[model samples]
Target chain A: MGIHLPSLLPQMQELGQALYERSLQVSAMIPKAIKALHSTAELDHSNLQSKIKKAGNRWTGAIPTEETLNLTYPPPTVPQSLHVIGADGSQIYPDRHAAAFYYLINIGSIVVSHGSGKAPTIQQESQLFFELEDLYDEADHPVQNAYVNLRRDVAEMKTLTKIAESLAGEQTLAILDNSLLLWMALQTGGSTSRETDRTLQQYLKLLDRLRSSKTGLAGFIDRPRSVSVLALIHLAGLPDDQINQETLRLTPFRGLTDRAIFTKLLAPGHRSALFISASPLNRDFRTAGHEVHFFYLNTDADGAVVRVEIPIWVAQDPELLNRVHAGILKDCQTTGGFPYTLVRAHELAVIPPQERAALEDMLQRTLLGHGLRPTQSQKALTKQLTGQRKQHTL
Target chain B: MPESPMMIGRVTRCSTRGFVGAMQISENALPVFGSLCQAEAQGGRSYVVGLVYDISITDDQFARQLAALEEVPQEQIADGQINRHVPVEFSALAVGFHNDGGFHQALPPQPPLTLASVFSMVSKDSVDFTSQLHFLQTILNAPQLPVDELLTTALRLSAQARPEEERERFLLQAGREVAHLLPQDLTRLENILRGLRA
Candidate 1:
């Protein structure tokens, strides 16, 4: 009664067929993309930048580095003894209909010492925001979810940096379970520009500290939907005069991701050439000397290609870059496709639904014990009562 | 006197006849099967003494997948065993209660509350509790338990709790109790008594 299953069947079948057709198209485009990558390997960086700028700052794509476009580096020599620290975060967003008006962020991290033959060290840090200043902004409105997510990202990065600093002399690589670029903070239109800028500043400052500590940092993105490389390939096939906003907007290879091309190109345990992200926000990151550079890595023989984003510092240092590449590849091999530390970190950070409910119950009880009445909105109560029962035809 | 009780786990579920506790997956020196343990109940006014009958470690989808791999690194194995949240659960059968500073060979008035601390009984306490073998009947009649093997293991552990010279005598007394508890079932009685030797 809730979903009208019979009515969904037709649409579901159509969706399946459409997906099949799209996959065929994507498969066909893979070779073209590869061809474009090879042909443009010698394309001058300045020429590509001029074309990107001439697109009226509308075209965002991968900006090629000195590395050839189609180059695939085999798994680098991973150090015999290395430390890979992964940090992930989970947050409970504030809900207006809930019994409380607050948010909670939990950052979980793991330090895996390869070849040490010892158990990995794991930690979790949780913080609750309930104070008036934390809950509301200067506009007297509750903080947005984007702001909470930004804070969670900051917390995760800070925890990683803290861990890495503690092992300053050791060969350590800190990995984040997200993109290194803080584009979400910059793109969230609802949040105040000043707040967004401040959060970005904090993130950049953390990167500075990490660089100073000489820690290798990377952001691992699984099954990335990014089309940065595909956008670049699209530009490769276009003439200089045709590289305008209208032409860039109507990409011939729409819905195609960089992963598909790399999956066909890179062998197992190999990585594509590194390129800097063309996001306008990266300009600010560039100003801060922490521009985000990324590459596609074939993590496994089954063609599991993931995007690995690193800072300019890591990309500039060959030794550090190799550590990031080899460490992540080795970590992926252990878990069958994804980094083990990131999976463990996510497991530690995730707050299950039952736990969230229990936390709410504890909060409510504490409030009542303190002579304060805590109650959920009527809407929330009705949903809870009905949601637990099976839907009836009547 | 007992030296000291080592807290092993916390009571997660309980009843008048038994209770279950969850231990850390990476807990070292886990209590062996048929080991004697106790849970504080009635706000520590009474202690429900139980014999550990079963200890199990459950695996999730992640662990099952990892196990299928040809090799897993030490870091990953450690992450799975120590960092992952899978619990090592154990079930204990209630056999007696310690109330008024005396051991009673009967179930307590109430089971321990959830989250009550459960501790392993020290050797002295184990010896004192099994001095009288009336708890054998409780073990034999408890549902969903390996009755014969449990009696054998519990009797052997209890016998070991006694002094070296007195172990045979203690097991002899326990064997007699098990025989009396299963009089009509000659095979079951023989099977239990056959395993009661120190």
Candidate 2:
């Protein structure tokens, strides 16, 4: 049966009211979060790191750097000849009922040469996985969606690195439409999975290549829900002795996100102080000299806050960081708020429903050419017939 | 000597009456209005020929949003113009077909298939196609198109394709064909003839 809007009205009204009230509470907690930030701004970096480590807190938070917690830096002048490369990826997971069982990952990238007043170079690469080893796990079952996502993430990073290495002479900044941390593998089966370890190694190798190329890399997360910095603020509010697992499991500012606080703290075209991600996966990245650091930027005057994650090298070099800041700001100004290169990259990578159907049709034709009759599973055919919307007879 | 055919675009939508082809934009130029174009049909055995009647460059929400911005970077404008898949579509009125090494001033037996390459007819081919002047009836009777203006433009282009000495004579012959086709509509014939003169 179709959803009845009239029947859902009362519950929707309740939901709206609850959300409104929660927003108010979140707003009230912002000032408290800010106060906590200022109160602990002067704490030494080593001390903060030791506090977070010794607390054995279950929550992942940000470890403060040398900069004060509340510091906001204005956008620096963009260099005259800057090359910005934005890479994004999309995927189609394997379907059990289709003519074939395979997943596809397409990575799209755009390289814009600033100050040249020329069109950007666009490229896309797609890979299809259908081998038994790719489709099945050690248990010989179909892989989950998480596995497909992990592959896509790895593809994007590899594509970015490959493109960056190709453009050797220019001052290049590589941007991915995600966090730099390769944490998706954790979702596949936790960090201990053999698959997770292999994926992490692959990513570290790519990160090493990017660093060696001296191509600054940044990951742009739009409207990010990360509360790493907020968790830091929460940790600051607690005394040293009370830092137990129970307190870390819950926060008074439950509904609040980090963007909520940074949106208020950062002015237009400014970025907050960098913080080191305290997640366990980041520790692996740190040991490899490519530690992930993040800062929140107000992309525009209307308060579009986006979290930018970079490696230790880019964060350490002032000029590289400013290029990232200014190049992203200028790209955002092209579109209203979001970076245009990333938008174009997504447009290049996305596979809509029609294209997927066309791909299946082509596969069927290919099978037919080889004297094989391609057929969908009975269950899939039935769904195609009955899954359509019901026509109303007036 | 025959001039080399210039590729206009590929046929996106096709029918016996007419076909719509997207213009292959280069150097920011479009196919001239009322120019002759040809697309192959029936497995290359037949060629459906048409006249360019309308050229349109469509705008989407993305372009409109970019335009609404206070300032758009040159690279962005270039990207939108160069990289975006949205093409400039142009409509053509099918007037004739070529088969068995002869030009027939009528619709083809079958419409061109989707993605059939369309090209501007070489000067010698245009001259040969218009030599009979029988295609004027097809353009003059297309009520859905701007008939009078299209006829005038097509005639002018056809006349230009001929030798300088035979240009006026060719136009006069086209004028007569148009007059014969519209015997009763004196005002319309006058407008077409007047347009041809201009």
Flag regions of model 1 displaced more than 4 Å. A42-50, A390-394, B25-27
Recovered share of real interface contacts in candidate 2: 0.74
Whole-model lDDT, candidate 2?
A: 0.87
DockQ of 1: 0.72
lDDT of 1 at B174: 71
DockQ of each: 0.72, 0.76
Tens digit of per-residue lDDT, candidate 2, span A351-379: 98998889889999999999999989999
lDDT of 2 at A263: 91
Q: DockQ (C-alpha) of model 2? A: 0.76
In order, what lDDT does every prediction score? 0.88, 0.87
Candidate 2 i-RMS (Å)?
A: 0.9
lDDT of 1 at B64: 88
What CAPRI grade goes to candidate 2?
medium
lDDT of 1 by residue, A96-183 (tens): 8988899999999999999997889999999999998777766778888888898899999999999999999999999999999886
TM-score of 2: 0.94
Residue-level lDDT for B111 in candidate 2:
94
